[model samples]
Target: MSTQTQTETFVLHNRASPEPVVHEPAQEPEPELSPKWRYPKVLSAGMSFFVAGVNDGSLGSLIPYVIRSYGIGTDMVAVIAKRYGTTFAGWLVAALSNSTICQYLDLGPILAVGAALQILAHVLRTWMPPFGLYVVTFFLASLGQAYNDTHANTFVSSLRGAHRWLGFIHAMYMAGCLVSPFVATAVASANQDSQWALFYLFPLGLGVANLALLGVSFWDRMALAPKRRRHVAGMSGGVAAESSGKSALMEITVTLRTPGVWLLSLFFFFFLGATITAGGWMVEYLVNIRNGNVKDMGYVPAGFYGGGFLGRLILAEPTHRLGERRMIFIYAMLCVGLQLVFWLVPNIITEAVAVSLLGFFSGPFFATGISVGSKIFAPELRSSAIAFVFVLGQIGGSIFPALTGIIASRVGVQVLQPMLVGLLGAAGVSWLVLPKDAGLHRD
Candidate 1:
């Protein structure tokens, strides 16, 4: 996920110069700026990830409450499937539109729009909207997240020591995931009678703050690009639109053609799918099969996320130091063992500890993948490629959860274990399959 050590430096070619700088350090020096004032935008981007993490993290804790509040029946299959289906749709829309949108607009307006959509979703949810509308809110939230986060990640992963920054932002995400369950569980159980949906008020407040942060930090890039950027300079409107469309199409085509993109996507496909599935259903499994209390079980996922928070913080540099490929595979194997402990062992306490440890091992997976991807994907295709990978990963995130819910609605949530095991193992194998030499056009 990170660069090789000082002995094996990356040779970043200067586009303006003919010579390559072979002696540059793998860990790039911090940008020369005031000590107190480096990149606040990195913090802003991290907050965006945190907001998304809050939104996603809450789901695992809230799933049981949603089913109970909705008074769902055998059609629970439809309910869960449809809920995640909307999530799938949101990612689908992002996949189709992110590249085109970036072609004409700056990241500022795009991020602003994404934050606004999330705020809108929370607004609708806090009122306890109808079931159908509630599902629609997920679509809005995810679409917003896709836009807001994909770009933020792309921007961060391009910097010096991109791995560390990627870890910071993604670790912020785990922090949100960690904080969310505590708040969600507290709010939900505070007045389980009628205020479960009130949990959204929390994310709603954060969403507003996220938008303000993005606006202030990204002020310069908030508007659409210059006319020359949107089109050929001096071209008429119709031709400009055509030119923009053609350019956007070309980026997507090129991004898709890259083998490294798809290989990374494969790793993400299973990794995200497994994590989302486990998080989304762990509460349900504990409550049903483990016979745990609904109120108490809601807090359990905090352990998972908390472990993840520590893992991302503690593991990023080491993973880089040891070797991203070998270390990730090792972590993946550890996760499989922990998942087995969660499964075979009947003690709820054992399961809880196991899940937490499982999370710790799995946490580095995301930041590491992105750091490596930045090196492997072409710069021109960077934004669209990462966007594609992210949305595809979100697709995996949505699909497995929906599938689990659908199957569990029939066979019970016990199936979550085997599914997770399989996906985790698949993720390990996929990581091993990545090209050993990590850099542009390694495909």
Candidate 2:
């Protein structure tokens, strides 16, 4: 054969038996950068809760001022104003957001709206509007809080070391609670003219700062349509892959139907009822029943929240190690003992100490509940489940305080002790009914 012919034949043979092309598994298109748990983002979220804590914690100390300024009684403030106006409205807005806008948007805008609402509410309070208008501020503030907190919680729950983060965020909340009383008390006390309206200035400033932090940390996710999971041709896995294609209504329905949801909600309902009742009414209870001075007893709620700060910080690891179920029951029993001491103790200082101890034991209940809920629900349904549980818990928070106020109006604030004991007992029982392994993977 000629050399040219041989070369052609060799080339053809090589061409016919082509080498295998090693396709590097098409590099997974770098995951559309989802918002992550950078320290700044975490701190901003924690600060949102801090703002909420300041609002909630100050209410107890300010209740006396509210009552006096508006010429309303405890029943009106607790039930009509706080329960319906603030707690109920706030949770309703939060529920609506979770079911609708949250499905379409990211955490940034939701938190911004929440912060704005709180600022508006505080502005109204600073003006000391008519009795009717004053109540509306509570509704706005609560709604804002619910919106900010619900999203912040869902975000934090998805991160590594979620338990510790949850505890830290809640501890920040308690820290806000601890600090708010001193400020609210001081502001309200310093104004002898009963113009405690100035106290709202403190939270107003915090609300603005909260809005600023959320804006900066979540800047990337601010746009509603862009941030949503878009299924690219190759990037199909992880959360986006598992993302439930179901409509928001369907997701909410599925979450509602879960037995674990109802059980957890029940536990939180009673738990929050006790918590809000103790914190909201303790000042009035001391002033009326124990003959505590208004100025001094105004700071009592701080003791309760202070204990909560310590408990969540100190007991988070223990609660996880010792078992959530076991630790909560023990805490309830301890709360009962402390309540008894508070009830029987005649001295104001002793009552204050007892109530503070009650707060300490009760502190871990909220963070632990969130930790457990995150573990139990399916990933897709987690947000709805948490929001449902939290809103229902807020309902309990509203109901018990309202009921206490009503009864106190008729009977006396002395009834707070018995009401707390009953609520705590109910919460413990509810916890018993939850399935041991309720998460989607377990089922």
Q: By lDDT, who's the top model here?
A: 1
Stretches of candidate 1 off by over 4 Å are 1-11, 14-38, 73-83, 226-232, 438-443
13-48, model 1: which lDDT tens digit per residue?
322211111112234322333323227788989999
How many steric overlaps does candidate 1 have?
Answer: 0
Tens-digit lDDT string for candidate 2 (1-443): 00000111111112221110011011221233434536677798889889989988998998998898788888788776656555687787677557566545656777788889999999998878888788778788888888777777766665555667778888889999999999999998886687688889999999999889889987865755332444323455555434423456676788889987888888889998988888889999989988889999999999899999888888877776666777888888898888888888798888878888888888888887877776666655666778888887788888889999999999999999899889988887887776675231121
Alpha carbon lDDT of each predicted model: 0.77, 0.75
What's the lDDT for residue 136 in model 1?
Answer: 89
Q: In model 1, what lDDT does residue 159 have?
A: 55
My TM-score estimates for the predictions, one after another, are 0.90, 0.87
The local lDDT score (0 to 100) that residue 377 gets in candidate 2 is 66
Q: State the weakest 10-residue window (summed lDDT) of model 1.
A: 16-25
